[model samples]
Target: MAIQKRVGIWIRVSTDMQVKDDSPEHHEQRARYYAQSHDWQVMEVYRLDAVSGKSVMQHPEAQRMLADIRSGHITGLVFSKLARLARSTKELLEFAEIFRQEGADLVSLSENIDTSSPAGRLFFTIISAMAEWEREEIAARVAASVPIRAKLGKSLGGQAPFGYQWSGKEFVVNTTEAPVRALMYQLFLQLQRKKSTAQELNRRGYRTRNGTQFTATTVSRLLRDSTAKGERRANYTQTTGNNKQWVLKPQSEWVIIPCESIISPELWEQCNGILDNQEAKRRPRGPKPVYLLSGFVKCSCGTTMYVYQSSKNYACKRCKTRISVADIDEIYQVYLKEYLSGINREDYLRQSDQQLQEKKQLLEVTVKERTKLAKRITELVDLRLDGSLTKERYTEQYTPLEERMQQLDVIIPELEAEIDVRNIQLISSDVVLTDAKTLYDEWGSMSLDQKRAIVEVITSKVEITKQDITITLAYATPPSSKSREKVSPRHGFMLAISITFAG
Candidate 1:
């Protein structure tokens, strides 16, 4: 009787591969049948489930079978088809080389190719090219479907953003988290500061929808995002560069759908206005300012004012204008104090409450908007998997959506604060005075950064021309909310001041 050759049967089945009516077990059975017909004994059956045939690096079973072949334990490795072994033509060729070097054989039952035969080796090369071609074709078809799925407003597939949950086929509003959405926009509008909002959120004991604390950066991003305006904007970013991070894509390619607005366009603009100019001037870290308003001061001629010679004077480069830093500082404080004197705490607090209540209502509707955007991402993934979306398209949309959800993860929790009419304690006028002499005494003891922080909170622009020095502040507050927590010993009123000093 002829000695039956010792062989191994290799089988792999991914979800898409199983759609071919070829389960791993069925492939193994077919391989065994083919081995039986060739008078070969199957020593081992190597199986990989839910594994892609892209590469052998991750397949432990396939690697082990290869080792066995190299050790002369098995004479052949048999699978149903060449592509089932590996989708890449280069990888298949490498496998062929490995089998050839090991003095073993690779046999595909369906393709009827045995690597031991000369004609079979030639057929392997041809089949490999065809397998690669099919993969590219499938990829092309998937890529072509991205705009189609996007136009149809389908769910792309990903974890739901805050205030929304996946409902299998699509995203649905998460009833429990709906209120947090409105509060976020309201907080930004009322506070006009991300750091203050973050502090309030942390103090209110509200966690993100994912149960994380809020940060200034996260709050800033959410406030800037137009999605809060009741529309879905998709495909605005794609993963690029070697490290694979999301960056902006063209606006023309964005998939926008109007669902429901969380914050009115007017309120969004108001909040974003403060958030936008917050980073207009970049300050160098660890550098102490020689002049209190160096970068903060701008020349009317559209150039930056710099401190010249003895720190007391600031000169403009383009306009050749100069102003005394001492004069600018004195007048700025006088105007600031004058502005604070008119503020009635109760009036502003009432306005803040009204803004808060209105925003809370708006945030509730944001749940619907979030669900639509979040669901659209999931739909893209489903479309890609089912051959409606290309991998490139799915990746571009899915990655950026995930990053946005991450931003939401940090923002949603911050919507909760301790600022309701009954609970919040506002600074009384007597307890926190905004007098210039009282501030100067505290300023003498503060660090440069602390001084700068106070200036940033108060001063918006210090413009110097030939005749006068005019510093226009956006708004200033005396010991209020989180701002007061950082700027100790001074806090009171919300005031905008314009102070002018003779140059």
Candidate 2:
């Protein structure tokens, strides 16, 4: 009997959203399909979900896979693409060397690279370098556009400051949020404490845009923001290092635009003056620890479970129904894999692509309209300059044209922003469908923060009980009309998986 070669599948999706949309089964099936074509047997799967490819050499999953390769547990490894394996050129080269020395084969489905052939080895090096270059080029282009967009008062992605909202590309005071934002300044002046202001706001049932309770940090930040005082600053901050810590850019680089004031500039100044004095004497607080499923976990008794006072378990205050952090995490990982594998993202992608095309068409029409209005205004100005028409007549014709031009200015930018957003969403959707197939294999290699981020995006709530657990997912559509509850026995516990999809 000819011995069938054993191969392991590698799946690594870079982003949390991608992991949410992708299914491990999809990737595994594709890899298995390839393996079957080559007369190979699939024995293992390695996943690095939501883990960065920048330097994956130190990751636990990567180490495990390497150990397996060296031990001959698997003579071959398969993955979606070259970049999915590793983005770092040096690391990719090192991986090639290790696989080569061990006489193991590496197969990249996307690039059609198989290390069993000499041509595949050459192609691997070339593709890795090209991939690294493309990433750098894209990043540089995005970085270059930020300052230009900021200076033009364009939407550079992200919501408007607390009190304001984008009204047709115009930064205007949000009616609902403005009052609360204005009160922050007034309350700060009266209380002289950010914490007290936050508490008062929460007590009054005022919540942030995301409907979260106000915190002292939120209060302090909103108070410091000059947007409420009519000056909106952009390109004033930059992120540093891998953790993306924000630091203020040089004052000279800041682009500040005047907008409608939520509060009087005088009030803003008074509040900030007190804040500035207090800040000098304030002690820095240590960073708070982030749990994997902090806010999403709930007990069957309808009470939220929290990890309190040196405990590794999340316990409800009402019923004291407790589950260890590790247990909930394991359940979440298993459920996510199963739920995602059954999900079909093709419909969603098609819908999103159609919407993106519609937005682009709208943007095109808007630009043309703006151009026509602009040309009409120039002609009106020319009539006034050449004295072909009386000043009164010119003003009559010019006023409405100029007004329409101003309206178009706002409309055009708003349309462009919408298109930009749509394009990004489509790109994300594409990434999700492409990368998620092997995410389960990569989950163990993810950092605590990465896992938490993924949980935050995909999971709505996780209900835990002695007998069962129900998990709700966000932005997912079930494959069947009446999807039955997936109940399975787990070490004397019955996990009743009730999947609910939310918009």
Candidate 3:
């Protein structure tokens, strides 16, 4: 008796909900039954979820299926339908050619396409074009609804502005953040410099909506948004590269959205009115100050501390509070000795190694998530190319996926860098302690930049007042001391020591 032919079954679905009944799972089961009835061996079952009609090579298992086919491990390939394999006529024909070249038979159970026969090639072209037309018509209907909703003043459907939250129907004032938004506008009008306004907010312990310290550039973008005046604008553009990104286009082309205003017309006018003058004389920003705790230091009065290069100290430009540079180094010596003492010294390597292991595991998870998103993007592109989905449907899904991909692309690298840094810091804890002590011993010989690098890595913040100094270490379990230690060891150290900085 002749040996039975081996075949692989491929199945795909755009969502998990679709797999429940008579779907990819059921279809796979049906395809297997068909293969068995025909006296064929089921070599493999290839499956993918949330995948669109992209190339087989774009998916993980799909690539394996093709490899098995090309290697002659399987002489036949089967699927429930042609739509699962491809959406466009061109792609359907291409898949047929690949199976032919690999000397494998292609069968689609629903459409009765048996590419080993001549008649199957004719139906493949005619039916795919018809399916493509149907998909385009469905997309056209969805795209037609957008302008109608916009004319009716319905929400355009995206994240709401900074000072407002979407209420399902429309945006309403976010009471907590509206006050901050108003104050930002007020401060900008008074200070005339967005950078100064950001500093003022930071001094008062104000942070952006996301809780990170705000920058001068952040302040400018928020104020210029014009949504505070109840006008939401769109069609903003960005430059392709470098520091000059998010550049706005002509004001005439902007589409202003009508919504509830957070600030008065006069306040809005006064703030933006200064833009022309500011731009005319504004010099390109100078290099950022070189200080160990550049963004981390806070003044006793609560504003950020700026570096005074001449005296080699940190001072608040607004309040004139200053801390001598040498004092911070002096305090570091105290921290290191306390931290590296008897019991803590013994536990250093164990503690660091544990933390590094945890961070590395999280990094691996993030990288995997990023890969899945990349595959989804490939599926979307293929769907759009074959007219399987309309431009509007593609955009609705593609835009957010791309945005998330960008965020992950940024975050993944940062996580990897953190893992690298933590490994170095923890694995070499003894060396860090010894090297730090030695650096202080030869402090006079080290350059300012060298000191900044060491200080930046070890310390998180330095808060200086007229009477005392408080330092926070970047360590997991800080060297314990009885100088008003926080109740929870989880909260990083809030160590305070009395030191006088002469005026």
Candidate 4:
């Protein structure tokens, strides 16, 4: 007598099948009888109870059966019917190819079909065509319902926008979102009055519907949106092909019912007028002479310091304290030397280098951990094939581990790049310090034009007081003088020196 070939039994019943009382025991009994009649050994029964055949690969026991087939543990597979194996035609054909390449056969007991027989191949092809047609038909029905449902003012499959909540059939105003909408209107008005651009408005903290920080383009879109004006404007174009056009139904064609107004129409118009004026003012003028402290200087009296061109001096509007630009520039240089003296270059470089090395080491460890976890997942898959682990046991153990491994994979690259950045900063600190020193040494020797460039780099602003001079320096960009004087940390990059007359 020829020895019996080892056979693996796969059984699946979708949720609807369970409602109809389809049982795995019935499949197991039939599979057992078929195996016995064929003189085949029943190695193991992999039953995916209450599982859908639509995505057969996701069925726990079905996945185990596939792994076993690939590992050469099972010589043949037996199921109840073609649909029991997979409802998806693509998945069914893929499984058929895998079994064929592995020299394994698939047997459906009720259909009296086996991949080893020519009739079985013809039956499978016919079944696959039917299943694919059914899927396409179901998809078409759902796609056809979308526009009809949307016209009915029903929820059409996406989350409702801010300031609205989904009612049973229509969107209703949400009280909680009302305040946020009001705040957005207020911000838009403020931006307009300040004569600010969209970028400036965003920097002052405007956000989007999703709570994400707003960009210039997003702000512009919101301003032009007719929805905010209590009107629906459409006829918008969505071109799929070059020179192809389709008439788009406007939002006004759907439904226009008033809920609540966040801002008055008068206020909204005023804001729009302000935005238009600001945009006009932002247009480029001819090249203007650069003022050393144009943007940086602030009046001690809490206002912007404006340079008076006729007087050739800087004056605080509120305080009316006038000082020659040249005198302030000289005073700024003296203060820069005092601030540079406080930093110990050798010590700062040593600490920065140590931090860079530590970051690099951490990055290496993270990479190794990610690699180890990935290798372990492959080993777990192999273990399932060798029958050392059941499908349920492998999934329960590997799923969380796989998720953690994916997170580590994303994080490791970010850490490595950060380490590289820190390393560069440490290596270049000395070069930056030397440049600062060179600029300071040449300041007195340079003409007014050259002096202006050096001043622009070293000092941002110079505020003169009755008793002392306060200088604000650029961050990370150091000044030339090397004096070991203690500077207060509060006024970041600031140096305060009492004015003294020559004795």
Candidate 5:
């Protein structure tokens, strides 16, 4: 007797409503049926019920499934579809790679993919590429919309400044916070020191919106804000690579919208001028050089390495592992060029464009056919009413026409939707490919700040040891318009490249 192949069933229902509307048990049974057909034993069932598809890898059930695959408890995993497995393209790719490494097969019923076969493996690659392209398109759309929304004086999805609150789409003064905020500027003007201003506010029992005592930093920030003078700045700042720090965007991109004034413009300017004078007086003789990959580079021992004041190398104090700043930059340029070139984007985009055009043409033909069928059915009804044709003949002619029209009704919409998706993918892919090419070709001409921005956007980590340096790249995907989902932690898959270099 032949031994049965052991397999696990994977089910993930993203929402409670979905679980209620569409039976998770149905999905399970379908997988079981697929498994039984192939003489595979149902060894385990992993369920992530009412869970999000964003970052399922950290989920307990997902971890258990991975453990089973790694431990050889199951040589196959059967799921209903790719989206049911994970919405994150990065996570999907990671899962495929892991399964491949473990010599395990993946069976997705809806997609008719079984990784034990060659065609199924090809489907996996195509699906992953399409998902990634869709994600990039969404991100590009969101980025493009930000400045337009800002210029239109629309709320950009954040809390109002300290002194103000959002009343619908309008920026209005917060009744309670406004007084304290106004006092901040007044106190700074009188005391001529941010720390003294904060101390005075704290002594008077004033607190921030978060119910915390005011500090020098808070006082300085509020006093410097132009919102109190009615010119509120929007789209002026953006988060860095790790999404932890906010850095100023270019002045040309900044939008200043008028809002209700909390204080007189003259008074606000007076306060800021004094603060500016103090800053100038305290300014250092020379500015510090900005390192491109500072705070991102880690020593082999796991401590963040940095280039100390005018140093030519990023050194780890704990591990004593060092890499020269110039060498790291050189390696990154080479790595980026090679990485971008390795992507089969040209061939993929060409095929996608062809498919898009075909879909559009099919939709046009479908609509015209549906229209002609409707006309034929109307003419048949007229002929029966006028006694020019028998009722039976009219019915015979109309029934087939109506049925064909119904079929076209279903197909036309699906074709239009597919066309829309493909168009977005093509546009997004073009932008990404153009940017990648520009980044590599213009590396030498780019300013330090420009280079740093690009590095932060793409790189997740840089680890250095005595023998080799590893760079981990993460291409971020923007959230969809529907969910407005925040990018989850380590949201994308990490692409690590090991480079041997002398330190």
Candidate 6:
């Protein structure tokens, strides 16, 4: 009677091996042939291609082979060579122990090493050392390459930031994303005016490059970044120590290139000043009354307005304009009514129709532009195929155009959706008008801050001149109070009488 030997064959080839003639198929064939000669039944062939042998356990085929061995599906293992099994000494030892525990044998065909023989055991140890050396050399090579690539202004490794993309070797500025970056700068400025921290900014819908909600640390980092100030930075590293941690390195030590400035340096300085002031104010101090409009109110002198309360009235410190809080509240309500009255819904409908027409025209223009770009790409592809363009030149030119086409594809859909929404809003003007009326009816019951938000949405600016106050409504023409020949009532209040008494 002849004993049948069930054997699992393992084959591996690293990324570098794929470039050579010696492929995974060649190794598999060799292992199968050797197994047959030894009268071993080939149970399964586990081929792992383009995967490093250093981490053999992570390879899908290797894992399956291990499972088969453990389940007694195979009593022997065969490979082209020991290195084909794993490139790490620790991994080789672990596999050997597994085979030993399972009462199975491992055979390397080319090395003539078998776990069943004494001489083969010595050879396995030598092969394991070689594998460990190979892994260490590869690691050292990678460690050396990263800094050189970074110095060349290439991305080493990490997720790309907004307004920039990684094109295999270099970081290229995406023009479409530039506007979003500019918006962040604008938002930061608005936050500075409100004397709010990054936590507050995040809570108000600000997000990071990855569209994740922002944290206080992320905000602080953004504020301190010279990149927002139109400077490029490099070579920054995060460090960890005994519990306490903070961002290190002086500003001078950072590699900075002045790209197109997103935010002016002066504005950056002003934001820093505001942040410092807010931090100082947060410290232990006497309890102060919290005013919702504290940061938003501005004096006529262009200085930040403060709310000063006296026994008699609230006074504007710079303008010396003293008015009772109740009188101020009444005047605010009257101003709101006047602003709401000035919004002629019919005129807005006419303008919306005009805008809809303009959008249609714009869409036609965009379609034409897209057609031109597609034709250009077709021409470039033909030129490259016909030998008119070298591979390098074709790639350099084609990549940017391809990226632009992708961006256009994304933008065109967004524009079309926006136009659709605008058209719907314009057509349903009556519905919007009804909603606005309802909001106005309940305006008096709203909190002061809520009232201010409502008023700001409808009115852009309200200026009180010596004779009459001028109100500029958003998306509408400004109205002069002097033009009113009579003390006309607006929003259920006489605006002329309210302004006169407000003084």
> Candidate 2's error at 302, in angstroms?
8.5
Of candidate 3, the 10-residue stretch with the lowest lDDT total is: 484-493
- Quick one: how many clashes does candidate 4 have? 2
| Tens-digit lDDT string for candidate 6 (1-503) | 22698998887778865726565655665566556545679999887777887787866787898899999999888776778888887788778766766778887754556553333444445645665566568857875675566566766577655556667765556566555555555666685643255455466675667678755556555666666566657655433332226465565544555455566788778767766887788868777654433343333454444456543444456676433345444555665566457667766667877887898788778778878889999999999999999999999999998998876765554455445434444533433344555788887687866766555444444443222334444332322232342232332333343122110
Task: List TM-scores for all candidates, in order.
Answer: 0.31, 0.37, 0.29, 0.36, 0.37, 0.30
Off by over 4 Å in 6: 1-297, 304-307, 376-434, 444-453, 459-503
Residue-by-residue lDDT tens digits, candidate 5, 1-503: 33689999999999999999777876776677667656789999999989999999999999999999999999999887899999997898888867876878898766656664433555556655765576578867887998899999999897898989998888799988898888888888889988999999999999888899999998988887899999999888865542238788899999999999999999999998898888888957787677878777888888898898777889999988877787776666777677666666667568778988988788788888888888888888888989999978878888888888777766654554445445544554554556756786887898988888677545667888776667665431222101111111232322234632210
lDDT of each: 0.63, 0.76, 0.68, 0.62, 0.76, 0.61
Backbone-clash count (model 5): 0
Residue 94 of model 4 has an lDDT of 72
How many clashing residue pairs appear in each of the predictions shown?
23, 8, 2, 2, 0, 0
List where candidate 2 sits over 4 angstroms from the true fold.
1-296, 299-304, 307-313, 323-331, 441-503
Model 6 local distance difference test score:
0.61
For candidate 5, the lDDT comes to 0.76
- Predicted candidate 2 versus true structure: per-residue lDDT over 1-503, tens digit per residue: 33789999999988898788775545666676667655788888999999989989889999999999999999989887889999997788778767866878898766656554333554545645665576578867987998899889899889898878998888788899999999888888999988999999999999999999999999988998999988999988876553458899899989898888888899999999998899799889987766889988989887889998778888988887887787777767766776667657787778877987998798788778878888888888898899998999998998888888777665554554445444444554454444554555578897887666566545678888876777776542444422344334333554566656643
Which should have the higher TM-score, number 1 or number 2? 2
Candidate 3 ranges with C-alpha deviation above 4 Å: 1-147, 234-257, 282-503
lDDT of 3 by residue, 83-105 (tens): 88876556676666667556678
Model 6 steric clash pairs = none
lDDT (Cα, tens digit) per residue for candidate 1, span 393-489: 8898889888876554333322322111111212212212333235645766887667765565455677666554566644323323211111111
